[model samples]
Target chain A: MGGGITLEHFLVLGLILFLLGAYCVLTRRNAIGILLGIELMLNAANINYLAFAFFGGARYDGQIFAIFVIMLAAAEAVIGLAVILAIYQNLRTIDVDATETLSG
Target chain B: MLNSLAAQAIFYVIAALTVGFAALVAFSRNIVYSAFALVGALMGVAGVYILLAADFVAMVQVLLYVGGIVVLTIFAVMLTQGIGDLAVSNRAVGPGAGLAVVALAGAVMLYATLRTPWHLATAVAVASTTYGIGNAFLGVYVLPFEIASLVLLAALVGAVTISRQDTPPPADGAAEKGRS
Candidate 1:
């Protein structure tokens, strides 16, 4: 007579999402694609936060962390995209592999 | 019991939607498709938040993540030329090594999650968490909240400066310099 959904279920989902985001980060050449991967990883972290809040305690601490994470993700995306645009202006390419002006 | 069963079903559906679209985001060759697929994946995450009784977080996820961040990402993708063209290879390089590493990491995480003895709390009544969250933000977490806003302001200024510095000199500036 137990509830079917367990904490493990949610944690496993977060794990899967995190791994997928890692894969995206490792494989994609597009700078924006890498940014997308980072976003995925952040969302996975958010999932873990809410899941823990739901099952670990009666506190709203986890939800607060999730909100903070969302805000940070927005800031990161804004800065990352701005950097990408600047790189494009300098190099005229968005391919992470090809943008090597900094290598010197 | 029946209600619990129905909740379990919804949970599985949302989990599937989240993971499936996440896979699409990882594998799609078209960057636009991947960006759009991220929308579905993030929406699924929001749905899971609702299932966890976090109504406020879910709404914020949809509004900020799906509405703002994803749209900004799509615009960035479009602004960077040659990314949208299918001729450009969006294919994953070093496939074998990447897959192996992902598998190894995923397996470790799954094992850890399933094996950990999590301190499970009794299912308490789901109260209005939005109020509690807001109160905490304005009360105990006020310092962190203010710091977050400050960080955001700094990031805004930094982004504007970074973008502005790279822009080619305006015609007026160039003419002024020539006249000088």
Candidate 2:
């Protein structure tokens, strides 16, 4: 409120988003839901990177890191979905609880 | 005064959109609904990037996330048949335990964030971050940049190979293809 916004605001927001992702990951039964949670967590980290970069006066570093993070997330999503598809093909279900062939 | 007020207002709006939709994404029972909610959450994150003056990153977020990842998620959801039906239980396991853990983790992060003495510089004129980032990737960070592209290539190949392994048997012919 003093001069508009602060790094703390961004950091707090990122934390909330990160926690939400964690919550989803913990609770969701679907593998794709877990993947979505992971994506959310990555984005939360991106927010922190940009906030620090902007406040620390090293703008490009944070932006570059965010770019890499985004690329990694995309790659992860592709591989994950493919794995999920394969799992469904093999087991005929995408439920993490039900697909326990390796549990023993 | 008015400008700062406007910025603060915008920040609040974006923050709400981000957190609210993210919660929806996390808790929604329908897989398709969850994917769609993720689109809103991701867009809010892009708005946050714009607020941080990372214009290039924001555009990339919109492009890669909104246009690509979200669409791909929805497509995957559509392709998988049982996901839409209630046969797939999307409910969270032990809701109390999960929320408790989230609360604890949120508390720890909030504490660390508030306690840390972050070195903040006076706000300066932010030239386009795109130029600097592009230059660094071409210069100092070139190796990492190339590696990221390689990762993408590998992922592309791997995805196709993995998903294509279960070709419909020729004996079952049309029936198996229709069933799949």
Candidate maximizing TM-score: 2
Fraction of true contacts retained by every candidate, in order, equals: 0.70, 0.70
Tens digit of lDDT per residue, candidate 1, span B1-180? 114878889989999999999998987887888899999999999998888888999999999999999999999988888776343333545656778999998888888888888898877688778899999999999999999999999999999888765445677675655432
Q: Can you list the residue pairs that collide in candidate 2? A: none
**How high is the CA lDDT of each candidate model?**
0.86, 0.87
The digit string of per-residue lDDT tens for model 2 on B1-180 reads 213778889999999999999998887878888899999999999999999999999999999988998888888887776775343333445678888989998998899999999998777696777778889999989999999989999999999889885665788577667655
TM-score of chain B of each: 0.87, 0.88
| Runs in model 2 lying further than 4 Å from the true structure | A1-3, B1-3, B85-93, B167-180
> Model 1: per-residue lDDT, tens digit, A1-104?
26688887888888888988888888888888888889999999999999999888855899999999999999999999999998988888888878765788
Evaluated at residue B75, the lDDT of candidate 2 is 82
> What shift in Å separates residue B149 of candidate 2 from its native position after superposition?
1.3
lDDT of 1 at B122: 76
Error (Å) of candidate 1 at residue A12 is 0.9
